[model samples]
Every structure is written in C-alpha cells, then in structure tokens.
Target: MIDTATAPGSGGAPPAAPTRAGRRPATTSGPLRREYIWLALLLVGTGAAYLWNLTASGWANSFYAAAVQSGAKSWKAFFFGSSDWANAITVDKTPASLWPMELSARLFGFGSWTMLLPQVLLGVASVALLWAVVRRHFGANAGLLAGLALAVTPVAALMFRYNNPDALLVFLMIAAVWTMLRALDDGRWRWLVLCGLLVGFGFLAKQLQAGLVLPALALTYLFAGPPKLGKRIAQLFAAGAAMVAGAGWWVLVAQLWPASDRPYFGGSTNNSIIELTLGYNGLDRLGLGSGSGKPGGGGAPGGDPGGGVTAGVDLAAGGDMPQMHGGFHPFGGQAGITRLFNETVGGQIAWLIPAALILLVAAIILRGRAPRTDGKRAALLLLGGWGLVTGLVFSFMGGIFHEYYTVALAPALAGTIGAAGAVVWAERERRWVRAVLVLSVALTALTAFVLLSRTPDFVPWLRWLIVGVAVLAAAGLVLRGGRRLTIATLLAAVFVGLAAPTAYAVETLRQPHTGGIVKAGPATDSGFPGFPGGNRDAQSDPESGAAAPGGDAPGGATDAGGDADRERAGGGGPMGDEKPGDEVLALLEQDGSAYTWVAATISSNNAASYQLAADYPVMAIGGFGGGDPAPTLAQFQRDVTEGKIHYFIAGENHGPGGSSTSEGSKITAWVKDHYTATEVDGVTLYDLTATPKAG
Candidate 1:
C-alpha cells in the first residue's frame, strides 16, 4: 500500500546536498535552524507548565513527604526511606525516588517548595529527553509534536507536579529507551550496557514496574541490531549483567545489613528487603496476593471507603447503597482490554492511544520490507512494543493499580505517534497512507468525544467542536490541495487531537491535589460523587470527611475539636491532606527532642502529618496500611518502658485487610488499656510515660 520509492530514509529528511568540502552545511541554515528554535520552545513551555503552581499541593502525598523529611534529617533514613528519623520503619517503596527530593530538602531546609521542586525538574527533563529521542529518527516537526503530546497529557501533568516515585520511574524508562536505541544503531556493547544500567536504576525507583520495558528492548535489539546473531546475543548478556550490577548492589546491601540496625522493611511481613521486593512490591502487585495492601486500599475512584457512597451510586435516590472496599480502585474498572478507556482512566493518559496504535500498525507495515537494521522500523518496534506491553499490564494487573500509574504509558504513546506520523507522512502521496492518517484523526476525535461526555457538565461544548474540526480536517486531507491548505488542515487535525487533553491538563494544574489517591481533570459523575460538577474541593464537603487542604488531619478523619469523640470512634484514614493544627503541633513539639519517637500512630499517613507538622520523628506503628509486623507488642512496650516513645496518637489501627491481630492494632489496644487519654486540639493522645492507670 505504500510507495517505497518516495519514502524517506531513516534520517526522515533527504540528505543535504553535498558541499565542496563534502561536509553537511552549518546547522544554522533552513530546517536545522528551525529544529533548534522549536526544541527550545518545547522545553521552555514544558518547564513553565510543570512549574506553574509547584507548591499548591503542599507536600502532596504526605506519606512520601514525611519520608523525605526524615531522609533529610538522618542519612540512615535517607538511605532507607524511613518514615521517621529514628529508623522505626521505612516507607514501603525502594528509596531511589526519594533521594533527589531528600537531597534538595537537606540543602534548602525541608518544605513544600524544596520537596517538590525536584519532581518538577524531573518532569521537564523527561520531556526534553523524549524530544531528543524522537528527533533522532523523525524530523524536527515530529519530535516537537511528540514532546507537546507528552507535556499536555493529563497524568503527565499530575505526576510530574506531584512528589511520586512514578515521576522518576518514567524518566529512567525514557532514558533507557534512548540508550537502547543507540545500541541498536551500531551494536555498541557500551550503549547496551548503559541502557541496562538505566533500567537497573529504574528497578530501584519502582521495582518490577521498570522491567515491563525489558522485553521490548531486548526483542527489538535481538531482531534488528546490526551485529551478527552471536555477537548480539553476547552483547545482550553483558547488558543484563550491567543491569544486575546496577540494581543488585542496593538489594545486596539492604539484605546484608543487620535488621535491628536498619529500619524494618516496611512492606515485608518479615524484615527482609528481598521479601519486600519479591512479595509485597512484586508478586502481590500481580493479583497473586492482596494487592500490595497499599495505604488507601482499593475501590472505585472517589468511592466511599465504607461503601456507603459507591462511585456510581446516586445519593438522591438512595436506598441501600452498595458496599465495596474503601479507597480508589487500583485499575479504573474491571481488568480487561478496554480498562484504559474507562471513565476513571481515559482522561488521564489514554487520549492519544487510539491514534498511536493506528499509526504504529501503519508505520510497521510501511517499513515491513526494509532491512533488519532499518532505524525507523526499529524505533517503531521499540516504542510500540513498550506502549503495548505496559498498557496491557496496567489494564489487567490485579494488584495495587492506580489511574496515575498510566503515566508510564505517556512517553511511549507520545513517541510512537510522532514516529509513525512521520513515516506515514513521508509517503502521503500514496492514497492508502492518507487514508490511514485520516482514520487515525477520526478515531482520536471519537475517543475525545466519549471521554468528554463522561464529564458532560464540564467543557460541554468542546467535545462537539473537536468532532467538527476533525470532520473538516479529514475532508481536507482526503481532497488534495495546495501546500498552504494542506498545512492548515494538518494544524486543525492536530488541534482536534490535542484540545481536550490540554484542557484536562490545565484543569489538573488548577486544582490542589493531595492524598494518596488522586485523579486528573474535574470530578466526574462516575468516580467522585459528593463534589458537584467541576467542584474538586472534597474537603469542603462535610459528608465526605476528607482532610482539608493543608490541615494536619489524616485523610479520612472528621474536623478537629468538637468532633473528637466521633473522630476517635471513626479512626484515622489514608494520607492526610492538611497540616497539623498549631495546638497539636505544639503539644507534640514540647520536649520532643529527648525522645526517640515524639509520638506514635497507627498508620504512616497519620504519623506523617504529625511528624511533618512538628518536625520530629513520629513512629508509624506498622508502616503503610498499618499491617506489616514492624515493631511487635514486646518491641513497642520495651520502647515505651524505656521512655523512647513519648505518646500514642489515636488513629486507625486497622487497614483494608487488617484485623485486631495486626501488630498495629495490638499496640493501639495496649496503649489505650494502659494510659490516660489526653485531647489536644481534638486529637486523642496517650502519654506513654505518664504512669499506667487501672482501667
């Protein structure tokens, strides 16, 4: 269907006419000059968008924020990603993602701005790297378009601005792809090794999620690499070794360290990093066990944790509301091929998927007859494979899935769309190529319409406008015209594809997103119910019982003060969104320096709020989800008897699957049984050293 005679080579552009000296002309002339200008604009625009309101979330996801604070104060905590400087328990994730933020906080004094600035920088760098990777094979225009797509992707906007490990994980994945591509170019062992090294570091960033790209990387190189079969196999082996060395050293050190001397491995049932990696962060994530037993617990997005208000429930017609697991659903919907297009997920990163896949198939078929070393086909295979593999896993994986995890797919989608668009455009004179391009634009427009319709009240007219423009652009493309008219039609097509996602991205920037689970765009009818159309302030809804923005209460608690009894009765929830009230901070800070733990609480998020507000080491009893057996009853009682732990803050002792038998629940029961409860600014606390009273 494609005319190979007119198709551009791997360089995308025709080779420049040879000069007298037989060298390429200076880059300042023509297309090369334009490329530089556009590249600069892309980077500048991406940086501004990402940094627009960097500190508005104010320590977004306080669970990790608390870890960053602790890491700043204690090198041991920094290395271990401990929730407290006293080395009580590490955060459930590996520490690589926190290192940059910790170092920033250590240098500038921990605060919202310092803690989140590094994440913004990582976001900007990822965009720039993506541009470079795409530009190498495609022309400047395609590279710029790909970069723009990623920058405006809603989830990319969310995670890049938020302090989540996903940001670093994404950056490493893109860099690895770039390095692997370089290896394929020349069969260079060093390039392959470098790619392996990046992936290894990626493992440290988020464990096995980093390995999803490996199959694509290895398969592409094995099939398309310039080296002979034996040599390519040997080179891949070296790269694998590099990957092990890069990621293995940390695993080795962590496993070898004395468990007592280090913070307990927070996610593991046993104090073993190996178990944490292989179990909690690994197998459990694949639906083999309770999905990670993560902090928020899994349910539909914005669904009531108690199942009183199901995500899709209509409170106006209320009868018996369905009860489901509390917290956001790991995947947006049931695990299936269409999961990415569901109401909860489509708006985040699925905007361009339909277009990307269409164009990917077109590009691969167009280049099917090219030699094995063809760079264009290799790139298509690499990016398309990455997107397909990662997308399927996110769609079907039964473990702790979140809508935001879709950020991993953004780079691949963006790159594939750009590369494929270029390949097909080069042969646009072929009627079939034009048909494929028009089909892609039409499908993308339809996708936007469906996604926008889910949140009908917000930007109601934009969806129709996108469809209108796409229809016109498709017509214009079908009917050959003058060069200016063709360019105009192409611009309209691009607008149709990008408009809704950009609007969602901007909305994501406008909102103040906090807590362990967050969704992009304005609240939709399917996921978040309490907030009316376009009202994202869940804290303002008294019925929601969510922590107010910047308030130091746990995520699922009532207001401080008059509701103390109800709050104590209800127990604490996931990540707290607000700062600790001043009175509570003062209470925790009083003579806090003398104790190893200024206070202790059931969940990491609750303890994170108090520790961050008081600037002290507050122990998270059983780590995130309050389920891990970190400090046993004996260990906690010993600490309390020795005056190491000063107070026990009343909070949720049980998590999604936890019970009274959990170590955290036992600690809470023991403390409540022994000490007099004191109400500080509506927070219940038991003084560990005030002397036990007969209950």
Candidate 2:
C-alpha cells in the first residue's frame, strides 16, 4: 500500500539525488525495477507477519480483565482503566507505563476499542517510521528491507498486536526519529522542536524506555555527523527544551495526586527538583536513588517493599521490615538489570549475529573504500547504535523476561540487512553472490517463522533448508576481499531470509495441545486474567485465598497514601492486604445495603458488570452501584449479616484461592460456617448477598 504512494527525493545528506518530491515518474529498468519489486514483497511480508498475530495472541486479556474488575464500562473503562479500575487510586509500579493508553482513553472511548485498537495502528506507524528513516537516511530499497525485517521479527510481530506499552513505545520512538530526520532533511529548526516534543511524548508514553532510543539518536547525531559541535549542541539543547515542554506537563499533573497515589515504587521518589522530572519512569533501569531499586538487584524493581527507611523506625508498629525513608517495604529478590540485558540479546541476537556479520562483509567488500555516497556512514552509525544499545541494555537485566524485549533492535538489524543488500545489488560482479544471498536470507527468515508457529516439529525438508541457509550465511561472512567478499555477503542474506519459513513450518507441525492445558491464553475457567492489574500484587502474595498487595475482598475506601490506619471494616478487623488499597476485591465481595458497591479502586466497572453477567444474572439495579469504599463499610457489614455476600475474592493472583491477611475479628468464621463455596467464571464462588442455603 505504501509503495504506490511514496515518491523519493526532497531530502539532504550525502549521495544526494535530484529532488523527486513532485518530480515526474523516473523510470528504471532491469536491476533497479527488480530491487523495487523485492522491496514491495518484503514490506508485504512484514505487514502480514505483524498483523497475523493479533488473533491468537494472549497478551491483551489481562488489561481487559482489569478493566472489567475496575467497574469501568462503555469505552472509558478499558483504556483509562490501567491494570484495573482498582489501580486508579493505587499507585502502579509498572514503569511510567500508562500515559499513551491514558491519553487514548481520553481521546477515544476508553473501553475495548480504545485499549486494543490504537496499539495495532501505532505498531503500523512504527513500521512506517522505520521505512522512512531507512529510506531517507539510507535509500528506498534499504528502507523497505529494514522495515520488513523489523516487522517480521518474532518479538516485533507479537508485540505489535499485544496491546502493551511496548507497542506504543516503539511508535513514539519512531515518531521521534521521523521528526528528527525530517528536521535534518529540510534544515528546519521547527522540525527539531517537533522532534524534541515527540521524544518527550515518548517519555510520557513509557518514561525511561522511550528515552533510550531518542537520546541515542541525538548522541549519535552529535558524534557521527560533520562535527559541527556548536550548532549541534545548541540544536540538541533546543530539542531538549521542546521535549520538556511537551512532556513536562504530565509530571506536574501527576504530582497533584497524593504522593501515595503515585508512590515512588521501584525508586521513583517525589523529592524535590529532579524527582519530579523522573520520579515515576523506569527508575529501576537507571540504578537506585530517590527511594527506588539499588544496583545490587541489577536495577530491577526492588522485590523488597520497605517503606523508605528515612523515617527511621516505624514508631507506631515497630515491626522489623526493611525500612527506607520511614516507609515500610516488603521481601524481594528479583532478576537484576544485568540479567535482563543478557537474556533479551542472548535469546534473539544469536539469530541475528550471523546475519549482522554477513551484512557487514557486504558493506566492507562492495562499498567500504569505494567512492561512497553522502550520509551513509553517519546514518548507519546513528541507526545501528541506537537499536543495539536499547536492546542490549534491556537484555542484561535479570528481573523481567518477556520475548518482545527485542523490538528495540529491529531498526538496526533492518539497517544492517538493507546496507548489505545495497552493496550486493550495486555491483554487477556479485551476481552469483547476490543469488546465493537471497536464497539464504529467505531460508533464515522462513526458519524463524517455523519456530514461532503455534504447532511444531516441522518437516525434515526444513532442517535441510536451514543447514543450506546457514552454510550460505557462513560463506558470505567468509568473503571480505573484492568479489569473494561480495559473494559471501550475498550468500548470507539468502541464508537469513529463509529462517522464518523454516521456523514456521516446525511450529505449525507440532503436536496438538503439546504444552498441556494451554498456559497464557483465554481463561474462562479462571477469571484471574494474565495481566498485572490485580487488586493484590501477584509477585508477593500467595494465590491460596490469603490476601496481600491487591487483596481487598470488600469494597472499602483504600488510602494508597501509606495511611496504616486503613480499615478493612464491615466485620473483619483491619489487617488489610499487602499494599495499601490492596484489598479492593476483598471489599467488593461483601454484600451491601441495596447491594451497592461503591467500587473505589482503579479496576474497571467490568468486575461489577461481569458479576452481573454471571451470578446476579439479572438485576433491577446492579450489585455494584459505585460508592466510596470507606463510606459503604457499615452498610456492607449489615448486608453481609443479612446474607448479602456469600463469598469474595480479591488480589492479582486470585482465582479460586486468593491471598489474605489475619483478620482481628471472626467475620470469616461466620462466613465459613454459613456460606457454601461455588464457582463463577473460574473465580472462587460464595453465596454472598444470597440467602443462606438450607442445611
């Protein structure tokens, strides 16, 4: 689709060509036309790979579940309801992660379409940006290849459809890149300002993660270009100021929420000056300070929830938990940042190393010392460095390990392939080499595809094909001098290109239900969705009916502001759940006057709505007529005694048996004696709000 519409020219940098922005159609024959054809095929392939995963993918369910849990309805529920509506009042520590969806929620309907649709579109935008960056900085063919490579990478494919912050992160990064490149192309300072604004928007989208790609681009520009030091520095400063202006407003507004509403978890502090600038971002990755994680944990989120010890001793309780700045924290030992980088790069780069090496060979052999065109080296340095740094830094961390972490490296890999492809195509002497390279590239990409398929154990023929591609890639790497080097690089491209198909064949042929009960997919049997917006923190809390971080079975006002006096009243004494406001679910389950649930948490209205779908089935007024959790306490108690609530479950990990704390009273004892357990959407069932069953 993009191919027919896009025309080249109207840009700057080395190897300058005539302005083609509005120029007549410049016809090319034989080789050039063939290259264009190849590019079009690759882009189509990329689009297919990314868009295909949208259906079978399981990544977006948790957010949907959380939205439901939060009592959010219509469109406003899904998008604005991060994790869940229960999280609305509670501070979430998933990096500075919700801004893009939050904005989307505000702009579009926050419900299903708002949360799910934007990601798909943004992902496509990222692909488009990648193409532009590669095409303008490098060449049209290179741009197409690079964009395709990114679009087809397994991680990129999954993430683009997954509805996570990472997809938006990619888009913001690409947007920033496109803006900056445009600025450079037209020598427009306004574009630089636009670049800065987008970069800052990137930060707002996901905080620290967005900065990785954008800053790297700037630094690369500063170091790799013509070295116009003064102008570059001034331009960068201006860009930075623009970015601050675009993104800084959010920080100010976030501050207005209670410091507790935006707790400085993972070391994000609300201290003076700097904290406001970076208080809620990926503070974990940046090393510890301002009440976040320390390097000992590899800059991962500190598993320990010590409420900042600076407050000295917990004068009130005097309990012996790790204390930081007078706050109480929890027990934790997580995968450190160092380990994160290794796994991300280690898992994916091995597939890429051979390709990168082969591409490099092509670069050196055909294009190295020869009369080079404009800005090629500078572009490679900038594009390659940013992709590598972003991927590597994230890989070294041990704490989190998701397959999609490799998206950051997409641009560079694409650049490398595009760079190599150009060299092989530019020279006529490398004809055979180019043929072999095409074959190998096709095989490697094919292999990757086979591996990622839902089913597996591919046909024997694929194994042979993989071996063939590998051999070609190796041969390409071997050639570095003149004709031989060009041949080797061409062989390499052919080798990598076919990897995905082989992988696909293998995955598709695997045994049915090979992995057992299907882990990461739909959970009609268990309402505990996969995403992390649970009322309780799944990391710390046990799944066995006892509540912790997100455990709140009753609907009561939860003060996220570390107000230890938090009451779990209705009949149970206050030993509330793990984190503050952690008992959102526990409170919601208790039967109330007129059966109204003033759901005060950040989860969606779905919890109430879905409950209506299941148990109440039909109701004149839904059981969850939203009210303040704190105010509804007494009525909730009366409703429970009147047999309003038969049971309740709350927390991040809760399904049948959720986590809980010791209650000072025996409200539970009465429940145990009178109520019978049942099931609703795989969640723990109780007769709450129902008349006690006859004995």
Candidate 2 lDDT over residue span 299-348, tens digit each: 11211122232224221121222223222211111233433223222223
Clashes of 2: 163
Question: How many residue pairs collide in each prediction?
Answer: 11, 163
Model 1 lDDT tens row, 85-190? 9999988778999999999998998888788889888988998888877776665677778889999999999999887788999999999999987887777788
Alpha-carbon runs more than 4 Å astray in model 2? 1-49, 64-87, 90-115, 224-227, 257-281, 286-349, 357-374, 398-401, 420-461, 470-492, 501-695
Assess candidate 1 and give its TM-score to the true structure.
0.89
| lDDT measured at residue 418 in model 1 versus the true structure, 0 to 100 | 82
lDDT of 2: 0.41
